[model samples]
Target: MLQMNDKKLYNDWAAKTSDSVMKRRPEINTKWEYEDGVVLQGMELVFNKTGDKKYLEYMMKSMDLFVDENGNIPKYSSNEFNIDHINNGKVLLALYEHTEDERYKKAADLLRSQLTNHPRTSEGAFWHKEIYPYQIWLDGLYMGSVFYARYIKEFGEEAEFEDVMKQFTLSYKHTRDEETGLLHHAWDEKREQPWCDKETGLSKHYWARSIGWYVMAIVDVLDYIPESYEGRDVLLNMLEETVEAMMNYQDKETGVWYQIVNQQERKGNYLESSGSAMMLYAIAKGVRKNYLSQDWFEKAEHIYKGIIDEFILTTKDGLVNVNKICQVAGLGGKDKRDGSFAYYISEPIVTNDHKGVGPFILASAEMEMLYEERK
Candidate 1:
């Protein structure tokens, strides 16, 4: 039941993601970075839905290259206090379930162990990373909490549920902007970071991708949260409110959101593919999981169509490319990123970046499944 465009774009991108790793892209191997985590996870989505052995084989081979016989993940130092590293741990659970290799379990355990000691704000939110002390980036919520929630569920560590939910609840409480109903990119508990608003302690504007990360985190984490858990309501409600806010800003003509979400009319602001893809995935998955209204079905369709019609271009060789992807976006990195509206729009836009391609694949998988269900 996959749409024609879904089959074309996702199939092309799936091959591209695996081919990139098979070639050992510099950023991809053994490193615990979430950017690669998402791509691997997206490959799993395709494998799960289509029963494609190659997709799963590619994912497993990539992990096997990095995770060793003793379940040790090379180049991953637990001392970094980086929640980004937690994202790859998501692949471990599925690998263990499929192969029942205790090494996968032990590998997952190592990642779960990091959450035990990861630093947190006074309000109990995790700092995005060690270097980003006292700040909670929306990016970290997806990177950390989805793995944390899944591990606790899979391992029967029910006691950790409350702590896991607190991260989501507190993030919404701290970062939400009532006027826009959009959460800021990150929140600085100390309000001392160069990007913070002295009075509000929140980043200056809503970057589409950051909000995309927050929404994707909850939708993914919700897969493991018990329906009876009251905290599930909190996460669902946040998803609803935030998506409602974001839909108001959707480009009326294109159905995609701007890089700086609130500045839709700004001269430099352009519609971004990765964030649009993430938003589509979140909405489609939310509706599929019954976490959001059925009305979101139409919204998801529009966004998906927008990405296909606006972002994807077919190459001369028939390979499809996803364009307008933000090459990178972060704060307080090596060069010192100033989290500003201008800073966001200035990032390079490229074709078929993992950030865009992975989410596009996941979103397509969700939409395909939804279409099958409705049929």
Candidate 2:
């Protein structure tokens, strides 16, 4: 198989997504959401890499629709504490640093304000959302802590640093399953939710994307956590253990992960692209940051090649598709997610999904740099 050019693939994906959504540009989905944030963060990384103002323009355009001249995000309510909403906060510091606009800072501060009083477990972790009370989802760590760590880094909130680090520490302590070394999807302290295991307070099975979210969370959040911090190495070691555990479950043939990661033999289990891409990003970035070793980079190289062959494909119609992405999954909402292995594999698979594409873009951005340096 021909080698995939990381830069070209990422650029093409972004252009295709931008064109598809052009009809709604100035009026883009201004929800301040995870999906939009994921894609735009990819765009932001690309912009950072290429120094092309176009990517910046795209991000600002969408943000402008929601942010007034004064920088109040209209629909955002910190009161509810939905971690999904915090995903967009990742891009704010980049915008503020480049533009030095008070609005960006104000907007970021608005998001950060939520952390101060956000509801938490008695042990001091933010609830995934208000509605999902007394619960912590692996997904929530990426969505919330990455921004929290970054805000502390930017604005010099030294006192809050320990709290930010503690969240990751506590999450690691609670969710990790020693037998498999894979953390479960979510944990309910009360264990009242239908999905949580009554004894362990952990969710039923290891959902790959939650692990993916978590791996990415630790790496990205580490960028803001000072290396000298007393607890940093503890988290770093935990990160290594988690990544190694996850790699052990990778399908030997497909090089991708399963929707229900641990049980490869289970019926309806299948290779999933988005989580695969996310793992690729986390591994590549972690290696790049020296949190992991040279061997891990080699491992990332192998996984990236696997992702290309398994998930990156050009359709007969000429659209390049990132295939096999699990569409959506959650626990205990209007339509209750039972958190079963079946519930995981049953989520509709999609192609070129923004969630998949976003991290793929970031992974590619890192790999592309590695590629260029090798040349």
* Per-candidate total of colliding backbone pairs: 0, 0
- Over 223-271, each residue of candidate 1 has an lDDT whose tens digit, in order, gives 9888888788888889999889999999977789999998888899999
TM-scores across all candidates?
Answer: 0.93, 0.92
Worst 10 residues of 1 by lDDT: 1-10
Candidate 2 Cα outliers beyond 4 Å, as residue runs: 1-28, 315-319
Please list the C-alpha lDDT of all candidates, in the order they appear: 0.83, 0.80
Best by TM-score: 1
